[model samples]
Target: METILKIENLTKDFGRIRALNNVSFTIEKGNVYGILGPNGSGKSTTLGIILNVVNKTSGNFTWFDGKTSTHDALKKVGAIIERPNFYPYMTAQQNLELVCKIKGISKNIIDEKLEAVNLLEWKNYKFSSYSLGMKQRLAIASALLNDPEILILDEPTNGLDPQGIHEIRSIIKKIAKTGTTILLASHLLDEVEKVCSHAVIIRKGVMLYAGPVDEMSATNGIIEAKTEEISLEELAVALEKSPQISSANVDFDKVVAKLNTEVSATEINKFLISQGIVVSYFEKRLPSLEQQFLELTNNK
Candidate 1:
């Protein structure tokens, strides 16, 4: 994979407070990368530094493999750090025309950009008349005006309803299919899990983990089992005594057990049957992103 952006030991400070502490990561081309953390965990600060909106106290970042000047490199990058404020009374088309003027870009591709964000039909609608979702879609269209090679979004789905979030995520997926690199900064774990191919998790200005999202899960297996013949407490006690399970407990109406990696769910089932426990339901579960996220942050 081609490297689009590289940060080496990047550190940032605001007076006595440190915003980022020797963070490093790489953004490869054609991957939707997510920067995830809690609200005050330096996600935005990192993005701001990379976009030259904030100054780094130490270390540096290279763009386009250092083949172009910072000014020229930024031309190929489109970013929306926060909810963009457009002229409320202006039509969507008129607002985009203004954006073109401000960015010194030609207004010829306004319709194409609008269509990309699925807002072409609403082009003539006044900005004030549009819903939060429509306004967000228009902001995306504005960012696409330059036909950038990379798109940087900060909390792209911040305050929208579930439907609006779905709309924006779909548009982002559509854009990713076109081979554009996307760098998303968000505190929403599920948003990153759904849209990002790779993720960098940060907490309290420290980098916790950075890699493929799938690799974040623990190696130990988890299983949920329910037995109708035996009490849930009985099942939990039996599983806890089994060598195949590290721990077992009654969770709600079911027995949730953490299995040893050396053993499989099949072994656990066979053992339960030997113990005269007939399970009504059984499932091997993969840990979710939220579960893994809580584990990572909570451990530190």
Candidate 2:
């Protein structure tokens, strides 16, 4: 795949505070890249610089095929930073029409963009009357007005209910399937895990980890086991002594063990039985993005 964006030694400052410090990464075409960090962690600041909405204190960035910032390169991108604003009196369609005019887009593309966000039916409804989800969909419609190849969204699901979150997530996935590269900036770990193919975790404006989501999850191994009325504490103590085990903890009725590497579930079961512990259920725990995020950011 081709590189869509690149940043080297990027730095931004706000008076005495450093917002981004020597942060660098590459975004590939046709992939959904997630930018994750805690509050005030510079995730939004980085996106702002990329969109040319904010200037960096130092360093350099290039976009689309590694071209330096230019009108031609920026024309291929679309973004919504923070909450989207619209005319409350105007309908969804009217609002999008206004966007089209600003972008010099032909009026014919209005319905096409609205349909991309599944808001075609609500296009005639007043923006003030639209629900939160509907407003978000319209925001997306505005971003898609130019049919950009690269899309950037910051906290796209913020303040949305469960169903609204689900709906917006589905729309994003569908857009990605069409070969549009997406950069999603969010603090929600679960949302990143569900939609992003790769991720870059930042903390205090520094890059902690950047790679495929699956590869990061595979680094920490976990095993869960349930025994037939056996003492979980005793089992944890025994597992901790095993050469393959890195750490062990007893949580309620389950014995959870962190392993040095991948191990077969059957091998664990047999080993426990040989030690006079009757195993009822056993399974390898898949590392969650949330757990990885907590470990990485907390350690920094």
Candidate 3:
């Protein structure tokens, strides 16, 4: 895969506090890359630095393989760090027209971008009359005014209802289908798991995990099993005896075990039965992005 962006020991310091610390990662050309972390984990600061909205204290980053200058590289990327400022009295079309003029791009594409966000029908409506979701969609349309090759969205679905979130997510998917690499900063693990192919998890200005989302999940899988015939202590002993099992915890009536890739759920089940334990419930679960994320951050 071709590299779209590369961060080399990127560091950012604000007075005595470091917002980002030696964060390094590479995003490929066609990936929906997610920068994920809890609030105050430097997700926004990282994005801000990369977009040149917030200056980094040290280190550096490059875009488009550094084939172009920073200013030129920025032209290929459309970003929304937060809610965009639009004249409340201005119509959506008028707002987009202003964006086009500012970017020195043709205003003729205003309709196309608005249509992409499904805002074409209300293009004549004043920005003040639009709902929160509507305003967000308009902001997105404005970002697309230049037909950018890369899109950077910071919590695009933040502060919206489930339906509104669905709408925005659909629009993002539509954009990605056009082969635009997307860099998304979000704290919503479910959203990132659903929308992103790759993930970079950070906490307290430090990088925790960076890899394919599936690979992250596979690093530590969960296996849930229960057998009424076996005592909890006996089950724990059995799992501990097995090299495949790393750890097992008795959570209520079931034994929740964390397994390595070398161990299959089938092996677990078969081994227990060999000990005359009949499982009443057995299930193998791949760790979700949320599960892996929490374990990596482990703040609690």
RMSD (Cα, Å) for all candidates, in order, is 2.5, 2.2, 2.8
Model 2 reaches what TM-score against the true structure? 0.91
50-121 per-residue lDDT for model 2 (tens digits): 888788999988886665455567667888877878999999888888877777778788888888778888
- TM-score for all models, in order of appearance: 0.88, 0.91, 0.88
Tens-digit per-residue lDDT, 1-300, candidate 1: 888999988898899998899999999998889898999899999998888879899988999999987767787888887786789999999999997876678999999999888899999989999998889999999888988889999999988999999989998888888889999989888888787888899998999988887787565757888988878898899888888788887877787787777677788889888988889999887666776788788998
Error of 3 at 20 (Å): 1.2
Name the best candidate (by lDDT): 1
lDDT against true structure, model 2: 0.84
Clashes of 2: 0
Task: State the TM-score for model 1.
Answer: 0.88
Q: What local lDDT score does residue 122 receive in model 3, on the 0 to 100 scale?
A: 100
**Candidate 1: stretches off by over 4 Å:** 101-105, 217-220, 227-235, 249-256
lDDT of 3 by residue, 105-210 (tens): 8889988888888899999999999999999999898878887878999989989989899999999888888888888899999888887888999898999878
Badly placed stretches (over 4 Å) of model 2 are 66-72, 217-220, 250-255
Worst 10 residues of 3 by lDDT: 216-225
List clashing residue pairs in candidate 1: none
